[model samples]
Target: LIKITYPGLLLEEILSTIAGNCLLCVTKLDFSAPKSLE
Candidate 1:
């Protein structure tokens, strides 16, 4: 059971990290780009 669970937990951790990085990148892009309406 431990062997099966370890990989799943690791995958979840990696996916979360990737998602967090993507969100951070998107936020940075939004901040760097100027809006025409502004």
Candidate 2:
């Protein structure tokens, strides 16, 4: 059970990190699109 638990925790951490990065990318894109028109 200990072996299984460690991998699960690591997977969750990696997924959360990726989700955070994706959110930042989206926010930056939204902020930039309007400026390009000018």
Give the per-residue lDDT of model 1 (tens digit) for 1-38: 86476998878888999999999999988977766336
| Clash pairs, model 2 backbone | none
Q: Summarize candidate 2's per-residue lDDT along 1-38 as a digit string, tens digits.
A: 75476998878888999999999999999989988876
Against the true structure, candidate 1 reaches a TM-score of 0.73
CA lDDT of each prediction against the hidden true structure: 0.85, 0.88
What RMSD does model 1 have? Answer: 3.8
Quote each prediction's TM-score: 0.73, 0.74
In Å, residue 35's CA in model 1 sits off its true spot by 7.6
For residue 15, give model 1's deviation from the true position in Å: 0.3
Positional deviation of residue 21's Cα in model 2 after best superposition, in angstroms: 0.4
